[model samples]
Target: MRVISFINMKGGVGKTTLSTNVAHCLAVHEKKKVLLIDIDPQFNATQCFFSGDDYVKYMEDGSDTVLDLFDGDVTRVSTVRGASHKSKKCYEEIKPYKIMDNLYILPGNLNLFKIEISAGSGKENRLKKYLDVVQQLLGFDYVIIDTPPTPSIWMTSALVASNYYVIPVKPDPLSYTGVSLLQTIIDQKKEDLDLQLKFLGIILTMVEESTLVYKRCVETIKSTDNLKDYLFGNFIHKRTEIPKQQLSQSFILDLEKSELSYNLVAIIKEMIKRIERYEEHK
Candidate 1:
């Protein structure tokens, strides 16, 4: 299975939005079997699918959540939890739903923070180990992991487990810093592990097309020969409605209603196709 992760050192760059929508678009629109693994403690992705009551029942009360896997020896199959009725039922009801025939989700909770604190040092491989179990226990064509914004053990673990990393950067000075921070860490990790990780590309998020600042930043990013290597041709435009829709749990029924959604969907489809081509060539 292909394991991919979406990450950025800075928050509010639409990382979660992109990750969630990409997984949904691939599964629902492309008819691909996808599994989304939420590694962020905020559980924003979890909230996108599950309600509080459902969380209490399926995640809090004796049932397994993502935290349980990292906190213990995840070699056993029992550490992972199955999709809950609430999540399943919700997916069934959402209009213009794009959850593909074989898509699944592993929810996250607030407790993930503590798990990171306890994991310490070499346990960063916990995510990789548990993913091995998941592959053996529940096979899927792809695994998409959504990580937290800040640098942390859990985030690093997710990177270590991924075959490719997609970075979302906003067009601003601080945005460049965030991208640089992650790139530095990724390079360090590559050297430390002596592993080769293909950088999928950087998606510019929350950009306003009319703004000179945005235009200037884009030019600057493109003008740098080395930075050019990090950018994806597809840049995500800033859209107020997208996040609002996500917050309201709106479904993408028709792409005609929102150009942003349409373009985002197109970018995601392009990414999937690119990855597939790479794998085929390999």
Candidate 2:
């Protein structure tokens, strides 16, 4: 299974949206069995597709919440709550039914935030340990993680678990600094864990074509030696309709036909192709 994480230290960079859309495209369009793990405590990805209100009630017996996993509960490793007998019951109760298939989500909750602090108190690599459980229980074709914006133990845990990392950078100067800081952290983790955490690619999101500032930001990202090699060749342009579509529970391919939607889909297709090529060569 290929484990990929979409992360950025800066918020509002469209990381969750990119992760959801890309994963959805890979599953619905490309026919890949994709598993999306919502590592972020905010549970935006979980709420996006499933019910935000009745998450606790939906969890199965012996299932682990985000908090339980961080606390080192190995028994609940196989206790995932999406698309199973337990989850479907909850889904039926909540209106706005989902059209989901072949895509499994490990729902997140606010309880995870408390666990992050508790786990950070110890020296053990909690995230890596949890990933071993995930690997053993559910061997997936791809595990895409949506992480929180701030640098936390939870974020590091996800990094340690991931093989490929994608950073979504907003078209801003400070956002580049955030990427730099995140890279440094990853490098340190690589040495500590003795793992090759490959940089999949840096995706530029919320791009404004007409703005000179946006163009300058793109040029700056391209000019940077460290990022140039790993940065994605495509950018997702800023568009209001994309968010509107997401709010309406629409897929990327189902969005109103526009240049921006076409460009975003093309970019995601290229990314999947690149990932496949990498796996083939490996």
Candidate 3:
């Protein structure tokens, strides 16, 4: 499976929105089996898939979540021993919720914040190890992980487990700073973990073309060598319909023909091409 993470060092840059919409587009339009893993403790991505009442029910029932994979009781064993190993056991235990025909989500929990604090040093590799089993059993075409805004064990684990990552940057100076910080973090993790993680691209979200700040940011991105090469050609413009549809629990693909839907479709196409290029080079 192609594992990708939508990440940013700053919050409210539309990370969850981008991740959810991309997964929806892949599953609904491309006929690909997509698995969305909500690693963010905020559980915003999980909320996107469920209603308020349903979310409460899911939390109250102690349904299987990402927390189950991180708990101390879950241990990993070699797959060479066949189907009776710990990996398969854990995989069977955590049942991902099916949202659509080809879309599933490994829900997130609020308790993840607490679990992350007390987590051991070995926790960084836990997500990677668990996904190994998941790819074998579930066989998804794409796995998109949504991470917290700030750097933490969860973010590190997500990066360690992903084949590629996309940074969702808002059209602002501060968001540019976040891009720099995230780039450094990714570089450090790649060297530390000996990972072959590729930079898919930086997507500009919530863009307002009329604003001077937006123009300046775009100019800077074009002028800067490092940022220019990695910035996606298509940007997501701010639209009221996005939040309206999200509040109504509507998928991007299900929305009426509008600018938001068009942008989402374009972004997903670009993402697919980038992934294909990475696979080719690899």
Candidate whose lDDT is highest:
3
Q: What is the lDDT of residue 146 in candidate 1?
A: 92
- Scored by lDDT, model 1 comes in at 0.71
**lDDT value, residue 65 of candidate 3:** 85
**Model 2 score (lDDT):** 0.69
Sort order, TM-score high to low: 3, 1, 2
Worst 10 residues of 1 by lDDT: 88-97
Residue-wise lDDT of candidate 1 within 1-282, one digit each (tens)? 888999987888888877877777777767677888888989887776666676667643544556655564332222345543322112112111123367677787686765536334676776687777667766667788899987777787888888888888888878765566678888887887765577777788888889987887778777766567667667677866676677556544234557776777778766866677677866
Candidate 3 has an lDDT of: 0.84
Give the per-residue Cα lDDT of candidate 1 at 241: 68
Summing lDDT over every window of 10 consecutive residues in candidate 3, give the lowest-scoring window: 77-86
Candidate 2 residues 4-81, lDDT tens each? 889888888889888888777767776776777777888777666654335555554434344545443223222354
Ordered list by lDDT, greatest first: 3, 1, 2
Predicted model with the maximum TM-score? 3
Higher-lDDT candidate of 1 and 2: 1
Clashing pairs in 1: 27-100, 28-98, 28-100
**Angstrom error at residue 46, model 1:** 1.3
| Pairwise TM-score winner, candidates 1 and 2 | 1
What candidate 2 gets wrong by more than 4 Å, as runs, is 53-64, 72-99, 116-139
